[model samples]
Target chain A: MSRQQRHDARVPIALAVLGWLAVAFFVLPIMALVLRVPWSSLSDVITDDATTEALTLSVFTSVITTVLAIVLGVPLAWLLARSNIPGRQFIRALCTLSMVLPPVVAGVALLASLGRRGVVGEILDDWFGVRLPFTMPAVVIAQLFVAMPFLVLTVESGFARSAGTVEEAARTLGASPWYVFTRVTLPATQPAIVAGAVLTWARALGEFGATITFAGNFPGTTRTLPIATYLALESDIDDALLISMVMVVISVVILVALRGRWVGAIGGMR
Target chain B: MGWRNWGYEVSLSIDVKRRIGATQLNVQFTVAIGETVAIVGPNGAGKTSLLRVVAGLISADEGRISWDGMVWDDASSGEFSPPEQRPLAYVFQDYALIEHLTVGDNVAFGLRARGVRRRRARERAQEVLDVVGGSDLVERMPSSLSGGEAQTVAIARALATEPTVMLFDEPFAALDASARAHARRLFSSMRSLSMARLIVTHDAVEALTLADRIVVVESGSVVQIGTPSEVLATPRSHFVAEILGLNPLSGQLRGDELSLGAMSLTVGAHGVDDGEVIAIVRPRSVSLHRERPEGSPRNVWRTTVEAVDRSDGRVRVQLGAPLPIAVEVTPAGFDALATELDGDVWASVKASEIVVQPA
Candidate 1:
């Protein structure tokens, strides 16, 4: 073989063994779960009332959360990426903080700020006679809090990497700033936006710790797939495995649909 | 407020000073309608920065930019018009075609932005694309276009706006020789239009051929502004001379004798009384010999061969030391002395061939 091919192929035996072991560590659990799945009754288990309710709730809350994230997060991402605003770095860090924060900590932080007896929550409660905790909206809020960072960080990075010259070229062609943003900047960054939205939706779909902590586990209101899966594990392992398999299938579909864009978004984060 | 030239009036006038990092860009020039001025400079010479200021992409720190008596930017009064409001089009170095849009849509962008109906804009875009020789590319995506095709589309986009001024930054840089020639012909045809054009290019040949007037900038300042012939025959500075591929030697001058450091040459009759002067010598006028040849040439120097570059059927011999200059020779002439080219040689130039200018 060629010299480069020979050099590349000559990996140390110890490293090769460790690499395969690491691969096995990730693959083993998924294999075990797949093996335990009762294929004959899988459809019946998935269509059961509690399972369907949790699945429906997960889909509904995550979709709404994804929409809200795009509405709120895109402008914030643009501001962070393109503006000359003071304290931009600090604001960006603040916006992306939840991405790295533990899910339970994010939930607690959300509760501390929006809980009935807490900071803005007390004012919201007294002024509007509204209680946010243990509600369906609370589930969405928790999911948004934990998941919006993925969208914001992804779109912001896309904006950072896109060429500013195209926008300038548009401006020189008599396009207003708003027109340039809508026609040029937005379209250029569409891949990042789509990738980020999918990532946010997936994160919201799989949310467990934050929903349980802040939103509480109610079958029709706050309980999502992960919450239902956790509760099912206490009584029925097969039902829990079915729910896990559903989530895995959805995740795989999203990854397959995203392909290179998802990998690019993840790489951009690093 | 405007200078009259023939029948048309000067439209764009700029006298600006801007400090970009360490370079202090102080430039002042005017582009009359139907006139094409080329900004020629080395890298980091603020040619692009000057274009940016004129296009209103960047504001000048001092002085005023006015077009047809309307103030575009006046740093003293803090009045500035952004790029969108300027009656101009900028062809960027990379063409900057929108990747998401079809070629037609890219060209139609300026018209659509100006509130033209979509149908009308598309019609106009097609018309302009036809004008720029890219009508066939109208339906194709910008990503699918070749370099020349992209350049044509960019020019079409700019033309769709019917702008009064055109700013181009190395517009032909991405094209191959044949494409560049095509683009040049396109530009020449467009010269019949009344719009003023300011093009920034590092290529001397491009500047000489394309520009009605050449503005040579060095270290963020205009060193010379003249017609191509005026600039070519008598370049003011060593930088300009070097850019024009001529050798410039600065010396003390009195009558016919010019003292170049310890060496001196008998320069032909230059009417201007001079103290310090620069003498420009064309590379082709310089002849290299094995020994000092018996000739009427007034100047002869022993020069070491520093480098030999061959291109376009000619050889350029770079001489080093006491006198550093370049001498051009034919391929056959070069072949005769090919073996001895690495060593020292005698270079001689006639007095009449040297152009003298006040330093």
Candidate 2:
């Protein structure tokens, strides 16, 4: 053996053994779930009224939440990435801080700001006779509050890495400011945007803590798939696993279809 | 040479001041319609900065740019026209074609920006592409094009705009020698067009070959402006002299004698009393000999060969010590001399061949 190889081989083997043990420790739980799948009664478990309603509600709310994130979040991403406004770093940090917060804290924070007796909610109720808490829209609001940060941060990094010179060349060719943004800037960063939308949709679908704390668990009103999974755990554990399995399947399909290249491109941005 | 016999009227006047770090650019010049002006200058002498200011890539500190009674920039009132609104076409050094677009779409970009229909824009773009000899490249992507093909598409895109004025900043700089010849032919065709042209280049050949007039700049200022012949026969500054392939020597003038440091030379004169004068002589004007020639040439010096560099099928022999000079000799003449490194030689030059300019 070469001298350097022999020198490196002098190190103990315990750490390598411990590293593989750690990998097995992390992979073992997913293996256990797949092993005990309860496959025969899966369809019967999922077709029940509460299960179907929660499943459909998740697909509905998450899709709507993702659409809202794109409509509202892309402009904010562009502003954060391109504008020379002062204290932009601080503003960006504030956005990141909210994403890292516990979901229960986000739910409580949303309730304090928009609940019936809350600060803005009281004025809103007095003036417009409108209420937001414990409603279906409240679930969407909670999910959006927790999920939009993923979209905003991802799209912002894409815009940051885009070539600003192409935009200048476009303007010199007589393209207006808005046309350049839509034609040059937006298309150049489409991969990040697609990856971000998928991430946001997935996060909204799996949102449980904020939705439960703020929107509550009424039967057909606010119970989403994750909420249904939580309620089913107390009575029927098999039904809960069936709904969880559906969630896992749908997430895998969406990720596999969108995951080939977008994730790899944004890998450098991270 | 003195702005005499000019047939065209001035259409563009740029009188602007800008500061980039320690260098301050303060230039004032004009371009005539139906005439092409080439800017030749040393690197970092504000040649590209002058074009960028005119193109509105950067704003100037003071002054204004006026073209045919239209005000482009007036700094005192903070009035400025952005690059998009100007009716000038700029072909950048790298072409800057958008990578995601097809060649036809890239050329059609300007037309589409003005609300032209997509089908009609591509048709118009195709017509111009044919003029530049790149009609077959319309269906190709910009990333797949060679340097010369991209340059042709860039010029085609600019031509589609039908601009009133045009600016090209070293358009041939990115191409190979063979490609440059093709680009040169395409550029010479632009002479028939009525648009005002200002081309910035460091190569004297491009200026003399393509430009109707040349403007020489130094240290962010316009040092001289003249036709190609005038610039060659009499360069006003040493920088322009060196750029035109001439060796320049400056000294004090006293009656018929030009005193350069410890050396003096007799000159035939229609003369001034006494002042600083610069005499420039091309390499072809100096002739080399093994011993002092038996002719009546006024300037002759015995020297040793320092270096011999060959280019363009000719040898440039560098003579050493006491006014070291370069002499361009033909291949047959070089064979006759059989010049070698560190060899002794005598150089001779006629007094009438020197160009003297007041400093």
Candidate 1 off by > 4 Å = B1-8, B243-336, B339-359
Query: Among all windows of ten consecutive residues in candidate 1 chain A, which has the lowest summed lDDT?
Result: A261-270
Q: Tell me, by lDDT, which candidate is best.
A: 1
TM-score of 2: 0.79
lDDT of 2 at A98: 60
Across residues A100-150, which tens digit of lDDT does each residue of candidate 1 receive? 889999889888989988799999999998889889999999999989998
Best by DockQ: 1
What TM-score goes with each of the models? 0.83, 0.79
Residue pairs whose backbone atoms clash in candidate 1: none
lDDT of 1 by residue, B45-110 (tens): 999999899999899999999988789999999999999999999998999999999999999999
Per-model CA lDDT versus the true structure: 0.87, 0.82
Error of 2 at A236 (Å): 1.6
DockQ of 1: 0.68
List model 2 lDDT by residue over A1-270, tens digit each: 899999888746898889889999977866776666688888787777888888888889899999999998889888888899899888887876667899999888888999998899888899999899898999899889899888888898889888666777777788888888888889888888888899899999999999998899887778999999988889988777777788878877987878565566456554
